[model samples]
Target: MDGQEGKATRKGPGAPRRNWRLYGVTAVGLAVVCGVAAAVGQVVRAGEASAVEAPKYAVGSGGGTKLDLPVRPTVPVTLTVYEDPRSPQSRAFAQRYAATFSHLLASGQLQINYRLVTQSDKQYGGSGAKEAAAAAACAEDQGRFAQFMDQVWQHQPAPANDALKDRNLLTGLAKKAGKINHDAFTLCVDRGQRNGWVAQSQSEFAAAGLGEAPVVQINGRPLPVPPAQLTPAELTSLVSDEAQRVATAATP
Candidate 1:
């Protein structure tokens, strides 16, 4: 997937397979980042030239003049995450915070939906990465997107590595996630039908000026800087504050 901007092509064999050791490295990184997201509200500032529009979700809230996600005070907030399977940062975020998000979901505090992007391969050299995106989409057909995403994030390989694209790995992860039929998952990956969804997500990311992984949007607006970078405590506070805002707004 490696090519210069505007001259990229999606053609090549997948990268080498990763050993189990890589998983350990990713796990450690996720732990550290999770702690950061929990203790500090750290987010990378958008580049001055990032060209991202004021996200649709931020158009009306007094905080930034953006409309908030139309969430009912009694219902959990739904967060949509744009991610790339080949990106380590995305994996780390998923590993560290997905469970917390799940807790909020169960408690009616938050909900989440994920959109997988496959554009990195064109810049990073993991041509097969798109395959992973397709596989996850296929898993979604079986109502297994959440399970598939958890596996992908838990076992995400380094960028430019094709290990994440292996059919066996995808199937193994799906099986581990308890997909009802490994054969169905395998068939889906082999057929490559879901690549369109990946392409659409990539297009959306590009239009949004999100050139990397782990782009998070609360409701429809991008999270402010501190929370964007997964600063633990800061993110927690922000979520709490936003939740309160949503709740108060709902009161008579």
Candidate 2:
């Protein structure tokens, strides 16, 4: 009789132990389902965020100049200037003022647009330089003008008396920017199809009496004085003051 009671106790415990294994399997399955659901939700959220941010970087979305100036004003004024990528003065100005200008643009205080001009001609052996400007214009067609300008200014070669025209080098730079249609750009630049536009910009500059490099115009008027070498702080102050002046002038 004691042996039968012991056997009965062992069988009752074994039944509940088997039930616990089934419960453990169900718990693990539910955990896997929840984890997969959470991962999918995160992916959807990321996609939505990307969608919202893409339009901010879209080129030519805002109208102002051919360069597509930002619509909102952080400062009360806009500065339009002509810049030659190969000019030493232009290069220095870009390096010095880039940071301040970028900050002001970020704050919506100022807008800047650049018109490119070529100083190199056949007599000066500027065929290569001319090609670069045309290639830059072609890149403009593809909405890569700002990037190409940045690269050209950063890597300009020194002016030598008789260097071979580097059409190849300029084309290589454009290709690196994903503008691989060199033939098209070369043709466009060679035929001077865009000369009318270039002439118009030149006319605007001349009418404004801007002869020298680094000419700055504030609210369609030339700066009362041009700085010999503009520092970042000076540029910041200049832009800030001009912005306030323009805002005041606009009021009745």
Candidate 3:
């Protein structure tokens, strides 16, 4: 059943695929901004005049109203990760490598753009994935995207079919992110403020020619991982080495 964004336990290379047509959510506009999101208009890349909306998960100091990539230039690596919340592989990888990623994030050695693929909802025959994705988008609105992600992956529902549509579960996950304003975050989740964007993210991901979730690209190039090592510690090492490699290559 490891088809398209599912666990790679029983699939040949590239056998898995996303049935985007069935997902039925429209993708949002693409923005390559530096920081997260906010309730009002957000800060964009300096001197940028486009009306492009702020990225939902922009990292910044002012509760996501501002978009600033943390840390600095010793290592410049951009990691564009496309993931589906219901995908076992995606959850495994995120939690398995959380420490390493957090370190890189803190050091400003890595620039990360998380692309969500809610199409797993259709592929897996449930709305759990899509709803969880919308919850994630709500978390981003509260400037706690990364934090909420960790909790969701850490406490991932078992059985693959267990729905993530439980409001109580989602709220608990959001609280782990920080001192969140529960009322606002809850309302955002209930209303799905970023549902359209959630849909559009998958569309943009496909448009970029990345065929599936749990896909990682470094500097716009695919960062290949053998299916065998999907959960090995070596996965994190590879990412670390790639960050260094990109930094070294950019050096004068």
Candidate 4:
């Protein structure tokens, strides 16, 4: 997560390879899940979760980012995740917490805002990061950001491979996501409508001084621990703590 020095606001240093150890949460510590049991229709890794009739969230666009909001508003703790699609660390973080995040969204307790960046393209020497990000943006337009994101990361190539630079591969992966309109996605990729937005978003990421990919924030604050060291139960605790703080502040 080291930041590259002497870089302009448009790009930053690429994230280094790091081993994101998945810490296991003990059964006793998992008691916190009880608070949001209603959202846990069945606990399963998000990568393996079946495609549903609809998205888990009401996907939308704003501020050069994709927004995933709960079906109904509740305390509203927003998780703003800045990610470079080509970064393996970002992939690890996303997949590791997918199911926990799914439950949080289902319980109407959290909102997720995904900010896509392409620093990895500069680091890895290809347009894959940009291409993948814009494709996700197009998916957002079609209300399939969640599904596209899951499939994209699950199918991410090696950090140096840059396979996503091929439009056919990108479009093919979209098709595999199901529910997404292949024709619209293909047209979006050809037109590159979201490319500029992707660039603008990268600029914002640079300006924000965010050091690396998978930079996660809760209610506008950085996570207490690095995303790699964070476990699902710890994330749940953090979100619930934020919810309580918001609730307390509003108590009259």
Q: Which segments of candidate 4 are over 4 A away from where they belong?
A: 1-72
Tens-digit lDDT track for model 3 on 1-252?
Answer: 436546555454434344453343333222212223431235443425665456764566756455764555666778887888888878877776677677767876677888878767777676777778889888887788888888888877862565687888888888877767899998988887878988888777767776656887777877676432565456556667887787778778
Ranking by lDDT: 4, 1, 3, 2
Off by over 4 Å in 1: 1-76, 226-228
As for lDDT, the candidate ahead, 3 or 4, is 4
**Against the true structure, what is every candidate's RMSD?**
35.8, 12.1, 34.8, 34.8
Best by lDDT: 4
Clashing pairs in 3: 4-16, 4-17, 26-200, 27-200, 28-200, 35-58, 35-59, 36-57, 36-58
Where model 2 places Cα greater than 4 Å from the true spot, the runs are: 1-76, 120-125, 161-165, 178-187, 203-209
> How would you encode candidate 2's per-residue C-alpha lDDT over 207-240 as one tens digit per residue?
7666756676766777666745556687678888
TM-score, each model?
A: 0.65, 0.59, 0.63, 0.71
Residues 1-252 of candidate 1 have per-residue lDDT tens digits of 335633533222222235446877899999999998866543344444454556564445456545455545473466778777887777878777866776667766776778888777887886556888888888888998888878877778778677877788888888878844777778778888887778888887788886577877776777887234666666666667778877888789
TM-score of 4: 0.71
How many residue-pair clashes does candidate 2 contain? 5
Which regions of candidate 3 deviate over 4 angstroms? 1-72, 226-252
Cα TM-score of candidate 3: 0.63
Per-candidate clashes, comma-separated = 19, 5, 9, 0
